[model samples]
Target: MTADRAAAPAVTAGRAPAGEDFGVYLVTDTELAERHGHGVLGVARAAVAAGVRIVQVRDKTASARDLLALTAAVAEAVGDRALVVVDDRLDVVLAARHAGHRVAGVHLGQSDVPAGVARAVLGPDAHVGLTANTTRHLVEVAAMPSGTVDLLGVGVVHPTSTKPDHPPALGVAGFARIAATTPVPCVGIGGVELADVGPLRDAGAAGIAVVSGICAAPDPGAAAAAFVAAWDGAGR
Candidate 1:
């Protein structure tokens, strides 16, 4: 039973769990800073202004202290309007919690903390999510311990410079196939642009996760709004 539970589905529904809708995933990088002249918090503020339902902060390079500070700033900016998610750092997640951020969740990649461990450490209320870019990983997500994660970042939907080593971009057909198999809210990440959000949503993405699409746009708020509009129109 223990072994079986360890592999139960993270999200049972094929789509986003209720109320989990279109979102903007933020990844902090030098390009984002250079282009926007602000860090993750600035992007989150813009996204929220543009009606983003959720925000995931993914900073692969920030130190734990830097991430914690950023997370606090992000939480303050988002306030009660948007769900704030920290990227692959459990310690940061804990720090956010300790700081009374009421943060919504944490998103982990394949090599980050184990989902079960994360669930246990994050407690039962905090939302947990994972990245899965392949059909095999989708199947694995479907079999993850139930309630271990609340959503999935499933992509590299198109070839991206962000994760250049990520397996081939899962084009429309591949997106559909993976979506069909994933029993979770699958958010399309990697190379998503405002123009692509609608189609990606149509391909069964619960939301679109972006880096450059929003952060690097001339006006991050407007770019995020466009994605929100596109997702709404896509009917996904």
Candidate 2:
């Protein structure tokens, strides 16, 4: 991580609903289990057991048909245990809704549909999040009058395999600068790990989005627990 990236307060790392201090950011990795050859449902179940409150299904490569099927299955696995979200593709979001899937919302990146468009399609109940890499971008999106979005993702705090083309890591300080300017809850993305939770929460992030940190672990449930513990300990 760059010097600026390291200087930001860890946002998602400190608090839990129970008022415990876990010192780790909330885990949000739905695609990581696929890397280890675990089925989507299995991975999601493991994540919920580990205290993950949210899951984002981000399979860009999956065909539309396959994506919907996978979404349905993962949604079933999460089943009230976690808030399941679909990444990008509003079509999948629609399909998930139609299938009686318990999807909580959609996460949109820069190239995906605009937040207003997504809100129109998903209706009033779904949660929407936007990705902002710079202060300008963050301000532009956060200041929009639409009021369609529920949250923002503010960084690749460090290099991440999940988004290879993402710009260089924003590190901690850059994240704090961007996050400090936004009123919406922010989640730090990219290269997040247990150790980074404390600083991330301090930076004002509502949570941390992770991929390999939990997915790549030998025991995903344990990994998930560790992440939650870290975030809770940080006083988020």
lDDT of 1 by residue, 1-236 (tens): 01121232333112223554545555544457566676667777877777675677766777899888888887777746666778888888788878888577688989998887888877777778888876667767767777777878887888887676798888777777887776677788878776776677677776778778777878878887787677766763
RMSD of each: 7.3, 7.2
Q: Worst lDDT window (10 residues) for model 1? A: 1-10
Off by over 4 Å in 2: 1-32, 35-37
**Against the true structure, candidate 1 has what lDDT?**
0.71
Query: What lDDT does candidate 1 reach at residue 170?
Result: 82
Please, what are the lDDT tens digits per residue for candidate 2 over residues 1-236?
11122233322211112221212223334466656776566667786777676677777788988878877777777746556777887888787788788876678988888888888777766767788887667767866775577678778999887778889898998888887887777788899877788898898877788778877777777887787777767762
User: Per-model C-alpha lDDT, please?
Assistant: 0.71, 0.70
